[model samples]
Target: MKKSLPAIAPGLPLGLLLGLSTAAPRAFAQEAAAPALEAAASLNAGDTAWMLTSTMLVILMVIPGLALFYGGLVRSKNMLSVLAQVFTIFALITVLWAIYGFSLTFGGTGLFYGGFDKLFLAGITPDTLSATLGTIPEYVFVAFQSTFAAITVALIVGAFAERMKFSAVMIFSVLWFTLSYIPMAHMVWGGGLLAEDGALDFAGGTVVHINAAVAGLVGAIMVGKRIGFGKEAMPPHSLTLTMVGASLLWVGWFGFNAGSAGAANGIAGLAFINTILATGAATVAWLVAEGLHKGKASMLGAASGAVAGLVTITPAAGLVGPMGSIAMGVIAGPLCLWGVSGLKRLLKADDVCDVFGIHGVGGILGAILTGVFCAASLGGVEPEGFSMAAQVWVQCKSVLITVVWCAVASFLCFKVADLLVGLRVSEEDERRGLDIAVHGERAYVS
Candidate 1:
């Protein structure tokens, strides 16, 4: 019998040689694929510490800033009710974020929502590093983002304040956070589809501001007009409370715009300066509009102007120079004032506290202006192939997408909540106000 040897495949020798030849390159590539957990060059340890502090500062914005902002805008009878709504919602968002919101917003590998591997914060520990944060603790990043979620939900209350049922508000908030907010957040920030397309949001123009504004508008409509709306003379019960809240928001906003840089660097510094200038310019611009149109600037107008400035500068804060921020502020002030006053009347939407006016309009303006003002010379990171016009078109696309997504989600949420638990307070609750009717507590004991 002939000695038979298993014949080697024709390509086996070549494959073996090729595999051996490429092994080192593959190993090298593997070694290179691991990301550094820290920055290439960290400057001041103090700077990092300050950023951590600022992150906490922003937490104050929604927990109290937004709570009191909406609280003081409603009637005195509904004051505590609104306050209750804000407080409870803040706590709810905090818990939900710990459970799933953070994962949904920041989890890996999804177009509209994040993955669930990090659900309930599993595997996240004191040492877990944030890939985007570069050595910053993942816990720190989560805490910072939690505040944004809290505020975004709180902002919607302004649209249906004093009229919405407490139970309904609670239910809808939890639902909408899961359904609308988290998905949009993933799309915008969490390495999702929009980010892959090179959209520059810097902060949360579409995610937070526009998201809340659109939801608020839809809730206002679906819940239907308040009993005395349009034909009534409803005024903010306490301008003093509104002023305090606005002031806190102004102070806390430093953290918001700057901390968005995710590092304590030159860009953060520039963002800080722009936030201040833009807010001041907008306040003055608002007063001017009120004086010219109404013969006197209202305190409410001033507060709204401050908010508008904050909203307008959010997207461009890291991208625009101080001058660009000031320009945006000047424009946002009057334009928002007009929208809040006469524009609501023209549209007849009964947006209770001008959510669409301040946030929606401001978000749009800031997003578009970001395209014009983003320059490498102005603390901006210019992406490859991104031009001003291209960026503007991209921003518009983002706005339109946000509007449609938010509109549908909000409408559906409101409708469902309405049918299940009812969106509006009873008519008796409306005339007597929600504090006594809904919460069964009077804001004033005296």
Candidate 2:
């Protein structure tokens, strides 16, 4: 009678009205949450595109880029062998990554090793989004990380190049990739120990460069020297090809650095610019150092410097400022020069392509400097409550961990390979060169 009861509630009892009143807000909340849920599961097309491009670029870095670079540095007789090794390693690692490698790296919640929950890439689909990346499809992330693993294993080939048996190299690569690379990658990048400890390897200072370098060093020592290593002259067969490969590496490295951002955003832009500046600065610095030390600035020195700069900036690619990257580059050139020369001789290990020198020395230096340059005062995008000293200490500890882990694991891997297939070819085979001895191919027909 008061108002004949309003429209829809005309016959509803008091309790029913009360219940409906309460349910209204709950229904509204459910509706509101639906969009958010959809968004959370959605992929950013731009990010996916960039990551796809980045994966391709990194593949370029391995195949022709690293292959040619390493091939040019070896003697003419061994050129085809170097290319074969790099190419084969790339193929091998890519397949392995799709199998257990990806699962053992990014699938678990362990402190040292990721579990096998994702073995065979199970439970993943085109629609699956990365929990960490949030927006990109998990498949893209997997492909991107696979490139990193491939290149890392390929890098070790340069250390024992021209001497190691093909079968031995393959065995060592499989073992080291499973044991050394996977663990280090988990610790640094896959939310394991070092990452938990606030280690600042923005783009794989410890995970990729240092990890590969240490393994390469160990392989060099265990594989022993090439037959005529110390007493002979082993000039690069084609500096021109080396230069071309270096150039390609420089171009592809943008993917290596900026792609780590996982998005086509400001951080990616920062990393791209830093890659250019640091590499350019490092090249000049290397030329100057070479001119001072050897009385000549060589194309080889320039190429080496560029690589050094690239390696040094990798750990700090998005963390440091432009000027800070240049400083890192400048420091990297000379330090890596010494690493290849003084450090190489001191160790008495014949590292054919200076894998330890440029990648190792530069990675350590970049990782340490990343701590310093990451200060907001130094134009870096500082971490929350950042302390340069604390970060630097964390960086040093990470480096120490990587070095020890890689050394021991690499040694064991080499031993296993040696026991299984022998680490070296016969002296006569080595003298004849790996191209003809192992692969039965020639780089040049003439």
Candidate 3:
């Protein structure tokens, strides 16, 4: 004659009251558990290892990879200067990123910039997890993201190479990194405005390539052409070195594109394969375009094509399939060739290394095409409630925003650096070569 109840849902004399008193507290306790507990539950060794490896690869891309690539493109007099600029920029940004850069980039809940709550990594610890990748320690995420800031700033050096003062380069990079790179990182990757609007940047098309390209273009214009630029031949000092540097960049980009997935999962694998396919296709497409246009496919064209493909595939790596990535590469090759050649002539900026031509045009192209290829109909990872047209609009919006922000910020930063320390070397020093005049060393001992 006792009231019967389900075994799992024990019918207490006061069912609602007892449930609130006992079950509610337990649920609250679970929700309020410490980060250490969460880490124990979800810390993934495989993902952590992969991210660490990726971090190293990206660092390699900056030091020897970018350094040598830019170095080989300049006259021998400026070779060492290129190395010095790239190395110093990398070192400086790494320090700044540790100080307040990480905090202002990913700490706060703001539309444009992050808060300074994590200044000098204030409260972060070995057990702290990143908001985006909960499985990895927050420190790993900081290191990984910091490398991105370094490479992006380093990319600007190529535009004004052989003319700018080393001091000016240092000052400008600090200002731009603090102002431009940090804000863009926050907006796209740090849960800020662009992210809120559902803009996609898998590995930094808008953030890295496009942002740097715009900044470089501005710097090239503001700094003025190298001495005797129009009249001088300005041939690359060493194509052999350029080829070697390009090879390193190609190898290191696997980490750049694939590592963006934030996990050692299927998406990472997809990014990896797509990077390989897209780069190869771009190489072929570039050579074909050059062969038809110039009557020969040179090593420079091949190297340029490879980089174009890499840039085009960066933002869409994980979102699209291999074939889609190949399509992007094929399109980017010729377009970027024109960017460095015809468009370079039109812009009339020195662009010592074609930063605008390759990175700028390729990034805009890739970012837009990502919208097309990310549709499930094109063998992409399907987004929930996806519309191709809507997504393309969002992509274009992101690109436009990045272009405007970077252009203005770069122009301002260059002007500031010019005010602080002269932006250019003395004409005499420039003619003498930065290696001996500025740094008192030579790339070649001759």
Candidate 4:
């Protein structure tokens, strides 16, 4: 039999075999490249317009909406400081996002950090399609995410309002946004650890709300109580303005939640309805709880409840059905009230605007409940292999990761700002208010 076998050609060398394996795919890829490019070129105009509008709405949230909301909550003496901080943070974060923030958050495929391949947006052209939402141009996605980054930083200003130096605020924002926000965004949205773990954060309960809340709490504690721990009146100067600001926030949130669907389609419409239902339900629940606790519900309670509802629904807007959204709102209203009252006292941090109380507590609740609600048994569009217990665990892990990272990074940022420019204004400046001392102008003249 051995003698009868025919002679055989020698097998190709190992290097040749490896090269053939790799080069064959590369050749096929080159052949198919034109079709991929053509597919990417077929951009949807409607999606582009919606994303652009969403970006504008989120910008409005930070500027007059958040600014006026926080401004009304502080004493009239410090009103200008709150407004100035919000406006300036928006401008600064926007610039940073264009330069390096977007690239670092969305460029690479690393677990904890992203690469600088798109540094200074060097490779992005008008024709380039987004990696995530391919129907829109990459530029529109950049602009949309920029607004989110701006609002996240702006939200933190509420916690340390009325006392920190403007210089300190500026410095702390840069550091925290760079260290805390970028990494969190990567983990949740940029194909990092959290995203890889199958953690579901539809619209950033962990990234936006919890991250900002923890940072705010840390800053408040580090800056110390605002001169008079528990002794002063410290009432909101204008609930009228507060109501208007809250109203603006509610309107703009439609874009914030629904627009996260990245298309002008059924999911976006569903998110829109959920946002409305949840916000309205939260408002009612807040009033009811207030009546039970204090015997009379104030307009302020309604406004705060609405905002809390908005926060609670942020993670679930596109994930859960209408009933689940309402349930979240109802749960969040009373829970957040307790957070502002009981948890606030327990922590003893001077979170001036209750940033941690409402946003933080509501965000956590929404995130965890989102996992439970997004089940086939609960009316959500569940996946084939969805497990409620598994998803809930993943959400908890995501929340824990965000809290620890933000807490530690923000503490370091505050320390650095303290070393560089100092954190708190003088006691005299605190009494006079940052509006006068820092800006050389008063919010209201007698």
Candidate 5:
């Protein structure tokens, strides 16, 4: 807990270098200089308070929310190892972001990445406001985005849990965050190639979910299969705990999607409602698919499907209409279920928690659908451009770039970490389980 707090609440001193103002909308003129907003989005007291709360909510998703979720899924003997990896990775990502990740992604610069104006948060102050959120201090904005960054790296643990070495996880966490995650965030959200071509990623479908997904698949392959893949049972140790954690993730995602709008307003409200509607629809679709695929529907399938829906809607939450969100939920559920149970088995990849199936697959689906449903006519927002053909092209390009980049970069990082500390534990350690071998602790005791 001590290690984690410093990362989320690092007391970056709020000196007088920067000032708080409203987040004014930057006007985008095709092939022209960026138009300065006449007035940035104002920082209302209500907005600031809500954002602060939402920011903390996202942070919670990593600390206890994700830790508990993944911990409960693995065997009791390996729980703390998974938990420690999640906890430690959160802290490491926080420090790196405080140091350089934020600047490289959000600092103003040319295509591909940004310049180093905000190194170590050099000029950030309590008063400095980012153009995106108006008057809230830029430091505050960075703090909120930090949670997203932390959780993305932590999620990779699911792919290689129960086998990976803790020290190796630490090394890859930093490298992937800098080389891969920062560049993708810059391109899709911070004003890179995707944004230049008018791609729509309200939060981080490409930046977070898809990037994590591809990296996860690579890790699963590199770490190789679990000790007894098809031969062993390998069932979730506690479905009850998994369900509880999934519930928290469901509730916490409201902050994840709505907060992306950057303030308390109509757009936030729309995102919140769509989050609920789409998640509900996906839950239904997923359970239905599971019933048809297997002899009976499983509780885990229902929860996992809801997550798939949430991932699919994340990128389009702000731009797409409500009905479009519902449609996305309906489609992504069955697709994700098929990917997890069918394709995963055929491929024989050991993605313990289906990270690529749900997050990566769902994110790609969401990115493309954002173009389809973002029509002013669909998602409650006034549509800017709803060319199915054009937006789909943009969506395809963005997903392709994110997948390829994340895969290649993550593969190299994983290999380097492996060669350094070794990615997986020894055969003796595997038999003993990672909870004891890697972390020297257990999740519970009699």
Candidate 6:
């Protein structure tokens, strides 16, 4: 080495030689780190695209899907009121979610609530990534979750439709969304107490369906029954519109369930097929039950059954096999029928659209059965050290916590609305129907 260095390094110091020897390895390491840095920052185009589509589909569920579904179920006198309530709630919640809702939901590590670290979505740019979702941009995740929040508030409107004051509805929605919806979402999906305790909710069995149902039940009781609820026939004015809305809900629910998987991978595919199978099975089961009970299957029964099946399979969409989904659907149809009829009479609450019956009952059934079917022995993608009994107990605990939280918070929210603006319209306004009475517009001018 000394002989070779004689030409150019004749006067080179020993220190300079040592420095040069170490520089080469350092340069190599710097070069090697460049690829890893790039990889860590890179976004998957396919996943980003899928998530964007999923966000749009969920929005569809709130607007025309849920709006029409609830609208058609109410009397013609309150049709426009239902439509207006659903549409306005969607818009209002979307704005709130962008402001502080997202932060309090997914920002902190708290057991009950997240921090305000992401208020106004601070510091999150297009380049930002979701730590939980990993492959998609953080913006996509925020948008997707906002839709769930909006629909949850909208779902409560059906329970108090045709009677609640417009101003009261607005005030109650804001309060309940802040107090109940946000915290429950954190507990189940945002890695809070239930999540840490291993409660399985693949898509929103606890957070969306049960949470909204409990709120709906509370509202139904607090708002009082519609005028002539049991005395008069309050049949649906337009079954055709309901069917269309149900169809849209069915289509959009694919995004709700499969998109929970967060990627266009095998799990998403599994969820998609399960949704179709379970929904179809539930529809048939409901038809059979209705025919046996009433000697005829109405279109309304079919639509209700389909929704029951959809809600039942939502929590287990990605966790269980197709056959398991079918079983859940079959059970949900009959159970929810009883929920709307017998259970409705038992509770003595006039849930206009049966939100508590289908969504509440179906969600509870699906959540508990998910624990049973999620075992590897039952053809599910089991978690590590999976035990059906332990998981079912965990599911029950989560459900109980959610029901209690929602019922209490909803009661407070309704009381707040009643204090500030009054919970129900006057007798004259209610008798005249909410459409022309509240909004000064008619759904159909006769």
TM-score of each: 0.89, 0.91, 0.91, 0.91, 0.91, 0.91
RMSD of 1: 11.8
Candidate 6 C-alpha lDDT tens digits along 106-193: 8986787889989999989989986545567889889988998999899888888889998999999999999999999887766577
Q: In candidate 1, what residue range of length 10 has the lowest lDDT sum?
A: 3-12
Q: What is the lDDT of candidate 4?
A: 0.82
lDDT of 2 by residue, 185-275 (tens): 8877665777667777767788899999999999998988988777978899999999999999998898998887667776677889999
Tens digits of lDDT, candidate 5, 213-279:
8999999999999999889799888888778878888888888888776666666777899999899
Q: Global lDDT of each model?
A: 0.76, 0.83, 0.83, 0.82, 0.77, 0.83
- Pitting candidate 1 against candidate 3, the one with the higher TM-score is 3
Our tally of clashes for model 3 stands at 0
lDDT of 3 by residue, 1-446 (tens): 11111111111111111111111222332242233244434678887898899889899888899999899999999999999999999999999999999999888868789999999999888888765466678899889888989999999999999999999999999999988999998887766777666676788898899999999999999999888988979999998888888888988887888788776777778889999999999999999999999999999999999999999998888778788999999999999999999999999999999999999999999989988897777887644455788888888998999999998999899999999998999999999999999999999985
The window of 10 residues in a row where model 3 has the poorest summed lDDT is 12-21
- Which residue pairs overlap in candidate 6's backbone? none
* Weakest ten-residue segment in model 6 by summed lDDT: 13-22
lDDT of 2: 0.83
Instruction: Give RMSD to native, each candidate.
Output: 11.8, 12.1, 9.6, 10.7, 7.3, 13.0
Better of 4 and 5 by lDDT: 4
